[model samples]
Target: MACIDTLLAAFAEVAVDPDAQLEKHLAAGKRVVGVGPYHVPEELVHAAGAVPFGVWGCVGSSVEAKKYFPPFYCSLCQMTLEMGLTGTLDKLSGMMITGLCDTLRAFSQNWKAGMGSKVPMIYVTNAQNRFIEAGRRYTVEAYAEVKRRVEECCDALVTDEALARSIKLYNEWRATMREFVALAGQHPAEVSVSARSSVINAGYYMDKAEHMSMVQELNAALAAAPVSLSGYKPIVLSGIYEDIPAITAILEENGFAIVADDMAKESRAFSRQVPETGDPLEALADGWCALRADTELFDPRKEHIEQVVELAKDNAAAGVVILLAKFCDPEEFEAPLVKKALGKAGIPAVTIEVDQSTESYEQARTQLETFADLLG
Candidate 1:
């Protein structure tokens, strides 16, 4: 329990104040790089001996970000750009921006124009048509640009051996995380939804190697002290950021345990480990190719719906929860499809509208209570 509490406290701190965590890392003489949404070459950053801190936007209305994006734009983009403009992310040695979505495409331009001087910027793109040889080549070239920018910023060459080592370390981290998520399910009575999310989210802000060690300890403790509850309900959370902190407590109070999620911010990011056998950069690019059905990326095939159904079945979940970020078009587009898929699979699901700066979750609470009641 002490180990659990300490890890949770650390995760909560970093989730709320990512810059503080990054600054602490910097003070340790390690360079940290900021990366925006969807896919990033974290292995490349790691290979260069730098930290790859996820720069998913904050929890607030970004008033200044309006100059670049409309009100309907994603808060993830809004708050991320606000951080760059406000210099909240100035401590980063550099930042990597990707053009996965329209908002991010505009954000890349805005960030370069506004925050590029403050923090050197790297433009990255994962090939959308990623199954073809041409797409693979394109992705490799794109990653080469990312590697070059990363090298320029750190003044180091990311050797094949270094990249291979990073890939191995990251794969170990991914394996540990998978084990952690599975273990979290067995002890849901003790592990709140937020606690589970935090343990996973901590990986983005902290060193993977260090996070993996602690996760291993936490998983061992959890496995040794498993909690059994006949009435505890398991569910899969599918969407982008499920970071509405209060919702977790409310869900636990209402008897929900998140066993699996297809969130862009959570499992989807690290589910595919970079292969250690291939040419390192090519392997990293190939990992990006493996990222499927993520709402943020361009996937006309929409395999995410199938993935969600499988997740629910595999977890024995009573239902699926759609924590849809309000005004996020991609997620909004996905919501109905997910609902339809779950419905067809005979799975119950509830969709709750959410935003970054939610002052109240009274509606969410009622919805959750109603969903939990239906699960019975």
Candidate 2:
């Protein structure tokens, strides 16, 4: 209980600071932890009283990261390492990475061999198989192992009550963030798309109460706005780590409304928290399994894909934009499949490749303008 209290207190400090977001909080004594893409098991980290930040590099710097990581390594890994080498990730005490793809597996090894400042590295398995029995077992084992490792890092043990409370708090936070996401889709300019994106992305790393406050502020701002059509080209963005709010801002300025998007970190991570339980670890394990099951490549429900199609259809979006991180295998792997499906649905789509250092917004603008023209 004391440990949970301490964890939440630390998170609140990071969340509400007028000047200190995660970058500022990292300077403090708290241990900064990193979680890779795919089944990060963040509930366990938050429960263990550690800060878990997602390590997708910010917009624009691929050319520099390329010097260190080979071309085979995905852009996401390169971006992460770029921050690590340049001392941006100095605040991190450790990293929790998964073997989500071949690039990630190799990058894990490089993290140990290459970086002079090696934060503690915790490697978790990324079950490639979807929701078969074997896959479920692999996920369960990974969740348990991650929970144990988080315990070791904090010198803390998991209590049933503490774990349950952490899960509940995080779930509430997720729901509220989701609400804010829907609001952003409804009114991008009114919400400050960048601030909403940062708050939700950083929420995964910071405390719950602080995140809740940020959401409340966003919700209040939305509620107070006047009602009207944005009078912009309706666009639905799809992909990962799309930090180029400049494009969205430009589109909005040109009377384009970013009605719906799947590119932002906040859009991807805002699911209900694992439910509270008498046995928190088991509950957490269940939550991880549930999320994986929902997002599995072959999910029979086809919910994720369906959601994308529905969002496009519902918004009557003028066109769909896909922003892929160069060398992001997961997005690369998923894009063609998504494009084909959406094409069948008759939604016009264009795909762009950008990295954390997105230096090509002008080129992208030309493409977006053309896409808008085609839709007309």
Candidate 3:
């Protein structure tokens, strides 16, 4: 396998200027809003004539985040909090906070107190659990609340037709993303690993139609590109944390490509919407149900295993890689169960635990090389 140093040096060269990318849209008289990990019906934001950027946190910048929130908060939340405190999110016209976890719920209140004048805050509850009727009802109420919040903050009436059109636009964007996934699954190098990951991440920054168009052009270019050599095995990247480039860099360098993934930020989410009806609220709820349903039921255990097995078999992934954060309790508890299942399925797997403030990219490279060796 290739050494980790060469890989890290190469990754440094393949950077994306996220700050510059954010500036481009902001200068065009567009408002940028932030959303966290829980699945957001971005259609509502789009219909309201604002741009919804999924704030996944800066991988190397979480040290600055610890000042506002406790270090115990997940890196994802910390990075976002740091960004808000530093006024990096000053360009944002507003921000939506998902009540996905305790940290985020606290984040909503802290952010409002700190940056409410510059960026408005909307708190949303997710419809992630299916068995609980109260869960579904809470989601519906939250959707309505989000709609109301956005409408009031933006000072605009959110009509049903606008929301439905927004849904159609986002749906197309989702289809475009799937096209990339299908291509990568079948032909990894036809599109460079980082390029594929970047396209998916780009969805958060631009309008749905514009983003979809960019992917289509990228897809056409990839389709016409030369085929990647075979004999390199496949791997399914799992666990709670993976930035697109981080996963792509490890896989491509080690001669193993990520054919599929179960990472919440990358693969598990897709376009979910409520139907276009006179009641925008109900339609929003219905859309969320369908979107989550597409990912499988809300049971964490079932969903995690299903993703690992399906990706492994369908893409012929040789092993699974759990790209987890060091102090993440939820993923830490679930790791053994997932590890055992992958073992029973005859797929070799490994874990690489990284903290939000992790400074050792070299360590990540080393662990990934070990994973590649295990697969061999």
Q: Give the best candidate by lDDT.
A: 1
Candidate 1 lDDT score at position 254: 84
Global Cα lDDT for candidate 2: 0.65
Write one digit per residue (lDDT tens) for candidate 3, span 157-189: 677888878876766777777776766655665
RMSD of each: 1.8, 5.7, 5.2
lDDT per residue for candidate 1 within 230-301, as digits (tens), equals 578889988887877777778879878788888778788768877779798999988887766777776788
lDDT of each: 0.84, 0.65, 0.68
What TM-score does model 2 achieve against the real structure? 0.82
State residue 211's C-alpha deviation in candidate 3, in Å: 1.3
| TM-score (all chains, Cα) for each model | 0.95, 0.82, 0.86
lDDT tens readout by residue for model 2, 1-376: 2232243344445533423556555566555577766557666666666676777655546555676677665667777777667666666667787776677788777776656446666778746654566876777777778777777765677566667777888788778877776666666555444444555555765556776876666666665666334555677777765555676555555555566777535455665367575566656656655662233234555566667777799877877888876676656767787788789999888887766555557877787777777866
lDDT for 62 in candidate 2 is 55
- In model 1, the runs with Cα more than 4 Å from the true position are none
